[model samples]
Target: MTGMERMQMDAAEYRDNQPEAKSAVGEAYEWVESFLVPLLAFLLIFTFFARLATVNGISMLPTLHNGERLILQQAGYAPEYGDVVVVDRSITDEDAIVKRVIGKEGDVIFIDFASGEVWRNDTLLDEPYINEPTMLQYDISFPVKVPAGCVFVMGDNRNHSLDSRSSDIGMVDVRHIMGKAVFRFFPFNKFGGIS
Candidate 1:
């Protein structure tokens, strides 16, 4: 071939090879963006901002069941009345405990065992989530004020739960709270946000 013709042929070959090189780099970038980035983000969120916990007993029956998996939000969790929380070693020798917040710091809690009523700050709580009426009484006296940075907790199953009502596990400290149970992931049939 002539010199110019050979140069043209070489240029065509170079053009043909360029797309494959660009395609490979583009594909790698796409993979990283589509998969790796999202995976890393998920890991970071779960590690720092959230956690996973499992229900161990029937104390929170009708609301939570045994072996049920839950998504707990850790960062920025503040104890609020009616929120379900997972605590860290608050109960004696127990790894963790899940209970609903009944009262916060400075709030007064009173329970009338005969009437099965729970009063918080002079207002009777209309607790529809409870498995039964609060008839089972423990050692703690009624109208007790929650100490500073502490919260009173109880299970939804009032008759069966051993919680703040009992002297065994009374008021929970704010620092002992690991996270709040926001959603239930296991037992797909009952999968939804924790009420």
Candidate 2:
């Protein structure tokens, strides 16, 4: 055989012996298309729609506990009374705390420490989620009206929480809110939607 023909024959043998090389590259491209790209999209969607937070203390005990994992939804967030929410603590403290919205702007809130009854806008506020009586009155006096563009929030564990009732946390500005606590995802036993 001629030198050129011999080289061509060798090249054909090499190609025939290595059938997997082409398939391996095609499989890699398929994996990138099917898995990697979708995973990246999923991550972006997750981060945009929700926030992940860990319960840092027992402030919301009996409802949420320390080290528990939670999902905070950020979409179309409007602060409403009774909604559990995650507040950004930069304006109040070093770390954030989760609490339930008790009153909104212009809502008059008053607590009777003796009876443990909360009054809002002259009506007795019905609170079944609180862990205990509202006995923890802070330095701030009550019959307080939540300021314009602010919200009154309190922990479920009222006796142990520093919340809107306290001067430090005050009325949380709507801007300082991180998101609404929608679900608990950790501690498998407690995995479900939150009120």
Candidate 3:
């Protein structure tokens, strides 16, 4: 063959012998889309939108037990009456505490230790979720008014919990509330939405 024909044939052979370049790039792109993107999304969702917390004590017994895993909703969460929440250690020297919001800001809370009753804003609470009556009295007195940007918290296990009624952890500030417990995921059998 002529020199030009030989060069053309050599170029054609080189092209034919090489592997497809697009396949490698396409695989890399697919890996990012299928694995990396989803992993980042999952991490972001778990970090900002939700969090995992474990119940540490028997304070929330009957409603939540110790060692139970909970999923907390952090984003756009506002504490409401009767909502179970996790509080950080801003008000106490201990670690995080979990309790139910008994009263919100500006609400008057009165616990009659003699009668084992709790009254909020002069309304008697229908607390069927409490493990027992409010017979255990802490240092904080009744007829207390929840200040602005604060919440009164209590444990379901009334007699055992050291909560807002106690002076050590009295009146949790709104800023100290980490998140609201939205679901229970551990123990497999008890997996469901937290009430």
- Which candidate number would show the highest TM-score if scored against the true structure? 3
User: For model 2, how does the per-residue alpha-carbon lDDT over 9-69 read when each residue is reduced to its tens digit?
Assistant: 9999999978688889998999889988889987986778888888899999778999989
What clash count does candidate 1 reach?
Answer: 0
TM-score, predicted candidate 1 vs. hidden true structure: 0.87
Model 3 C-alpha lDDT per residue in residues 76-128, reported as the tens digit of each score = 99999899999999444678989999999999999999889999999999998
Better of 1 and 2 by lDDT: 1
TM-score for each of the candidates: 0.87, 0.88, 0.91
lDDT of 1 by residue, 1-195 (tens): 899999999999999999999999999999889998889999999999999999989999999999999999999989888999998884467768899999999999999899999999899999989999989988898889999999999999899898998888888999999999999999899889988
Residue 8 lDDT in candidate 2: 100
On TM-score, the stronger of 2 and 3 is: 3
